[model samples]
Target: MRRLRCPYCGAVFEVPKGAVYAVCPYCGTTVVAKTGEEATRQYYYPPRLDDGEAFLLAVSRARMLPGAPADIAETASLARSELHYLPLYICSAEAWVEGCEGAREEREETWLATSRLPLPGLEHGYRFPVVGREPYDPRRARRGVFHQPDASPEPRCSALRARVEYRAAGEARLAGCRGSVESRAGLVGVAHYPVWLIEYHHPLAGQPLRAVVDAVDANLLYLEYPIPLERRALVLGGAALVLGTGLAAAAAVGLAAGSLAASILGGLVGSAVAASPLLATGLSRTGRYRYRPPRVERLFIKG
Candidate 1:
């Protein structure tokens, strides 16, 4: 037996074993029922840590310069974090459409449709499969409370329907397969993923830096760092020295023999000087950082 909550009347009801669909006695809404086997086989992600603490851990590791800021440390220490389980929906369907191309007067028109026909007596069908899994592991605990599913199933299903509509309009053969509208294939469900959030103290300044990563995926999400005014000046001065020295050498060579070697040497020096700023800019944009428990491992759900 399984318990069901009515979407229309908010009534609760007990569904008999093996029942697929049940009609709400009070509100007349058709609710799909899950089987005992299906209910027991679903996999869930366990919550590891609260959002605020996770954020702090991440930021601490995202190396800020020495003597950064006091405010940065305060902000990192006072932030909040949240945990959630999002849902992902999947579907398989047949699509048909009509389209046209060319000029209006002598336009070419075509009607195209493909169907698997569902094997005569087979009715419309839907199946939800477990694709990728994200588990929360705050302390590397062997057991923990799994986060409840929070994402609505309807929107996910609607996206899938839109994809089917779009596919039907395109010039392609519809084969037997499962698909999603905006997400990657083989990702049928978007279950809630875990993440660690961190705020780190900047020693020089009074401000803190923010960082986030997928606890399960170990994918870094955000990072921010500032470059010192002195470093910027140093880069500019170095570039000027490289350019001026090269130009002076080239002039000397021209006065001596007007040789190709002088031109080649000048060009190389000029290119290096011109490219220095770009390299420095790239480095400044990507600030220094590190993470603990660094290996990324994919989680798979068997149920």
Candidate 2:
């Protein structure tokens, strides 16, 4: 490994041997090590939330969940709060197609860079900031842990160009009759995005609950809260009551109608109709309670 000073920020950082691109941690500048050396502008999203604000938001979210204890927001303790800066590469492409009818130009499309720890939200339609990003400052660097990219930017940049070109060409072809298409990849740069990993304790839960929040927008990406026992028991008790009443109604209907089919139909309808509310509540509570998968839980807390 060798260390080099960033011409723009004057921050000295290390790069692996034979690496084609190195991103400056302090300034978000990328240095190209190709024949004609070059530098690309990069930016980092500033975090709008602090640990206290994030914890409050988490508690608010937890309290809003169905079957959550009413006082969870007040009683919950903030166990941990960490800010993380995830890296991304931004790439764009422009394509034009010419056909017998006319020529059309497809709008420029962009592909954001991905990393090993891009996290779940990025892949599941979580849009990263395309605007309102600020240039990295030394003071900002001290705010959180700026994760280093696992791989050089060259590979991701290349992949981005390829992906954009292919997608643009495909869209152009689909828009009109197959024609000659010209596509060119545009600027590729690096960015560090901010996120918050928060862990909190609730008396209802066995362990600390984890929440992933977007530091840029102060939005919750992921959260987990336990269902209050009283709520669950109340729902179950209502269900039982409805079920018993339905059974009695079924017997009455059968005795009045004097038919087995009528009795069965009455029983099924009564049970379903009377218990619909409780049944729905139970299903919803159980489903939401079971929503936290161990893998995802570990990813946010342990990863």
| Best-fitting candidate, scored by lDDT | 2
lDDT of residue 139 for candidate 1: 33
Full-model lDDT for every candidate: 0.41, 0.64
lDDT of 1 at 145: 19
Judged by whole-model lDDT over C-alpha atoms, candidate 1 comes out at 0.41
| Residue 99 local lDDT, model 1 | 29
Model 1 residue 147 distance off true place after TM-score fit, in angstroms: 15
lDDT of 2 by residue, 105-216 (tens): 3332223443454444444446566676666655555456655554554554456556655655565655555766666665546667878888888776777887777887
Could you say which candidate leads in TM-score? 2
Summarize candidate 1's per-residue lDDT along 103-195 as a digit string, tens digits. Answer: 011111111001222111112221112334333222332222123232334444455555655654442223333333232222132232334
Write down the TM-score for model 2.
Answer: 0.59
Candidate 2 RMSD to the real structure: 10.1
What C-alpha lDDT, on a 0 to 100 scale, does residue 203 get in candidate 1?
A: 45
